[model samples]
Target: MHRLKKSPKNARKTPHPKADIEAIGEGRRLAHLLRAKRKEITKAEQVRRILDTAHNAHEISLAENVIRSTMHPADQFEAFARLHHEEGMAAEDIAARFGVTAAVVKQHLKLGAISPKLMQAYRDEELTLEEPTAFAITDDHARQEQV
Candidate 1:
């Protein structure tokens, strides 16, 4: 039977080897995800390299895992509204940029046009998303707010 060799019991390990391994794993995972989604090998490689070269790679990985969140629906509506009204971007253009359907963009536009008071209510969790979406069918801010 073959015997496996083991390191000396007192051998010193590399500094923060666990952290380094975690950072490398996170970078590889992100690179794989980006490549799979965008089909951009160069961009994926750049992202991986950037993560690998960070002074506190493990901290960055931890922050990304712990702090990052999906954009809130209300925030998305407001952003889409701003792009359409303030930036003069059409629903189709916004849809293309966001990888959503034009119909979904239109829905967001409608929700964005809702009364500011109601939007605030939505943000505060006083109203459900469906309620605001229903109100979006009308352009009358006063009527929407009154209801």
Candidate 2:
């Protein structure tokens, strides 16, 4: 068996009219330049920047803070509950998907149903995690606001 000769790294598949003048070597460099143009975003690094700037500058903060903090217990529960309640998913199905009990799903749904203002405050750390429980116990937004 005869071994085939390997092509040069800088060789172009198709011969261009300007190949001699411009050279196939530039093609490899151009390909590398194009690849280097891509933006690589590390989510952890992005979140760290957001968290570092959150207290100092509100304008530069991440709009989706809940998503950035992927492991926060309350965020997970609230997101699942929101999916179930707002998206019309069954609580049992949500429980099955999340590996939690139906009662837990119901509890999260109740918490997710709290007033948006209170929820935002909770997210911003202005209110304690448990503070929303009082509001969640009742269905009335007006009543929740009163308290």
Candidate 3:
């Protein structure tokens, strides 16, 4: 069994093996699920071995928890729009590729149709995501911008 050396500052507070085992189990389960879906997740990609000496583990944990964020809705809409118009992909095809329902893809496409000015406002944080989503009711750029 591998043992994590306790930090000198907290010699009594060593990491629990049970927690590490559970984390590994969860990683294996995720790998299996992704593999079943034909996603290319190699075993190495599923579980990474981090040397305790290579970096500060606490810092890594903090970064993982704090630095990650979901893609902005406007950016998602633009990507879907590009795939639909520039790549000539149908909504259903884009949906399948992204593992989303066709309706969701259609909604994104509608959001993409919002006026560029409104989209810019959203990107600039001047408008909330819902504001642009509401503008999606009309495809006319001039009409959307007017609102």
Candidate 4:
């Protein structure tokens, strides 16, 4: 490849000895530089694209609100009450996995919207509620100790 001869027109195009020398480090010289710069884009352009995507998501979330939040503050407590208060999952068992309080679980039970039968089941040991596969509590201090 080093021995390959260039046409007179090629010499007329780029008449620089340094360009030829730099072809080894800079990849085939002047023509490549022009091509690479033309191909490159900017980070600002990528971020603009991501923000456009979020704009569409925000619109949908505004419509669904509570349902959109999945397990919100009160929802987390309610789910726990069903599992522990009704299903007989002990306070410790609920706390170990959910990382919350026995009292908080009880509070959610009182506040939740589940069926009376289900609530009674958790309390009576007649039925066991399965903990949600995954959930989050929007309540920050519920799990936090006060004293």
Q: Cα RMSDs of all predictions?
A: 17.1, 21.4, 14.0, 26.5
Give the per-residue lDDT of model 4 (tens digit) for 104-141. Answer: 66656544544433434444544444421111222322
Total backbone collisions, model 1: 0
- Tens digits of per-residue lDDT for model 3, 91-136: 9999999999999999999998788888879877899988998888
> What is each predicted model's overall lDDT from 0 to 1?
0.74, 0.62, 0.72, 0.45
Of 1 and 2, the candidate ahead on lDDT is: 1
Query: Per-prediction TM-score, please?
Result: 0.57, 0.48, 0.57, 0.27
Candidate 4: where are CA atoms >4 Å away? 1-70, 113-147
Clashing pairs in 4: 85-122, 86-121, 86-122, 86-123, 87-122, 87-128, 87-129
Order the candidates by lDDT, highest first — what do you get?
1, 3, 2, 4
Model 1 TM-score relative to the real fold: 0.57
RMSD in Å for candidate 1, one decimal?
A: 17.1
Task: Give the higher-lDDT candidate: 1 or 3.
Answer: 1
Counting clashing residue pairs in each candidate, in order, gives 0, 0, 0, 7
User: Which model, 3 or 4, shows the larger TM-score?
Assistant: 3
